[model samples]
Target chain A: SQQGEEDPQALSIQEGENATMNCSYKTSINNLQWYRQNSGRGLVHLILIRSNEREKHSGRLRVTLDTSKKSSSLLITASRAADTASYFCATDARETSYDKVIFGPGTSLSVIP
Target chain B: DARVTQTPRHKVTEMGQEVTMRCQPILGHNTVFWYRQTMMQGLELLAYFRNRAPLDDSGMPKDRFSAEMPDATLATLKIQPSEPRDSAVYFCASGLVRTGRTEAFFGQGTRLTVV
Candidate 1:
């Protein structure tokens, strides 16, 4: 079963506009990570924010976690045409002696050049 | 930079044929994982191994699917008599487990089509 669900399933944006995607999960998580997938290719790790942390940034990516609300959002600042791809949020749930990470359906962002 | 690698980037087989996909994890990584992705199921973890020890395989189907890590470096997912419904992109990921951090790096994935 998927732990997280992403909103705004598809978004079209201008090259310089920022794109934001939201993810909601059902259970408590150890950490939440964002990933990017190019069409027909593998996924790339974007940023990982631990439970105790509220926000993190990497390059043009900004991720914020609101554990109180069981939600997180990924914000891409000054997006470019190359940044057009599918974004997914995966939640690492704390299980006994191990962890299970469940990925959401993902949000497809298309940037017009 | 170290990364995981998967073979047979694409495979098309008729239904009822055996299919095997292989993965090579990054050196010194102790954990490996296999996951399948489709338009409907999204990404599902089929199995995982820690130091070549099978940790969990509850998500895999018993009748036709099997996953094994024959050694520390190699892991394989085999499907006997695959069905059209099993067609999906199978991805292999590996990560280092140290302290309280677990970061997984994934391969390019094998796109399989069972017609």
Candidate 2:
């Protein structure tokens, strides 16, 4: 079963606008990571936020995690046409001995140029 | 740069035929995962291996699917008598699991078409 579920199945916005995607999971997680996939391409790791950490930032990407609510959000500031891709959130369950990462149904984001 | 590598980037086989896919994880990475992506089901975890040993394969169809890690560097997923419904993009990912950090690197998926 998929642990994380991303909201807003699809979103479209202007190039300069900011895009926000949210992911909610059911069980406790050790860490949450976000990934991006361009059309016909493999997924690329964007950023990771550990459960002990509340927020993290990397380049134009900002990620926030709330362990109590079992939710995480990815914010892309000043979105560009290059940002047009599917964004996925994955969770590493704390219950598993190994890092069994479960990915969620992604949010398809289209940054219109 | 080190990355997971998948062979046969595009595969088209007839229905009821056997199909085999291979993945080579990065050196020293302990975890390997296989996923299938389709329009209906976004990404399904078929199976995974830790330290060259299978940890879980419940997500795969035991009748037609089998996954194995022959060695620490090689992982193979095989489907016998593949049906049209088995047609989807298969992805291989490798990651290192430590105390606090986990990140996976994906390979360009193999787009399978079982006609």
Q: Which pairs clash (backbone N, Cα, C closer than 3 Å) in model 2? A: none
Kindly list the per-residue Cα lDDT of model 1 for residues B4-113, writing each as its tens digit. 99998999999999999999999999998899999988889899889998888988998999999998889999999899999999999998876555778899999999
lDDT of 1 by residue, A32-60 (tens): 98999999988898898998999999999
Stretch of 10 with least lDDT, candidate 2 chain A: A92-101
lDDT of 2 by residue, B39-78 (tens): 8899889898888899988889999999999998899999
User: Which interface RMSD values do the candidates have, in the order shown?
Assistant: 1.2, 0.9
lDDT of 2 by residue, A1-113 (tens): 79999988999999999999999999989899999999999999999999999999999999999999999999999999999999999998888777788899999999999
Which segments of model 2 are wrong by more than 4 Å? none
Highest lDDT: give the candidate number: 2
Candidates' C-alpha lDDT? 0.91, 0.94
